[model samples]
Target: MVMRVVVIRVKILETNQQVELDVKSTTVRELLLRLGLTLSEHIVFKNGEVITEDDIVEDNSEVVVFTVKSGG
Candidate 1:
């Protein structure tokens, strides 16, 4: 099977960092892993909407990862 590559624009709210990544069109869980994400204290937004692990990361799409603090 052939894998599809797409450009992913990621914006990390806490660090004010913006990065562009070229990744496969797979599940969000895999994509996040590709980005070296290991924690679950953040939320992901795709196209200004909430996304889950089972969601597909579309080609040429933008994603935002917002870090949140809990149990204050």
Candidate 2:
């Protein structure tokens, strides 16, 4: 048996760049790790909805990763 990879569109707020990639059906945490980004340094949103590390990511989902900022 073979498995189909899930595809998602990712957007980076810092660079204002977008990319479509094939990913495994997994949690947001794994996805961020695969993207080479630290979950603590970026805020992730799925299809306009804020998502947590444990959130499940599906195919054709839109994800936006924004760099967390510090304000004083």
Tell me each candidate's RMSD, in Å, in order: 3.9, 3.0
For model 1, state the Cα shift of residue 31 in Å: 2.1
Backbone atom clashes (below 3 Å) for every candidate: 0, 0
Candidate 2, pairs of clashing residues: none
Per-residue accuracy of model 2 over 1-72 as CA lDDT, tens digit each: 876656888898887988777875668888889878898898899768799999888887888998897754
In candidate 1, what are the lDDT values of residues 1-72, reduced to their tens digit? 966556788898877988777764767777667767744867789989999878888768898987776547
Q: How much lDDT does each candidate structure score?
A: 0.77, 0.83
Error of 1 at 9 (Å): 0.7
Error of 2 at 23 (Å): 2.0
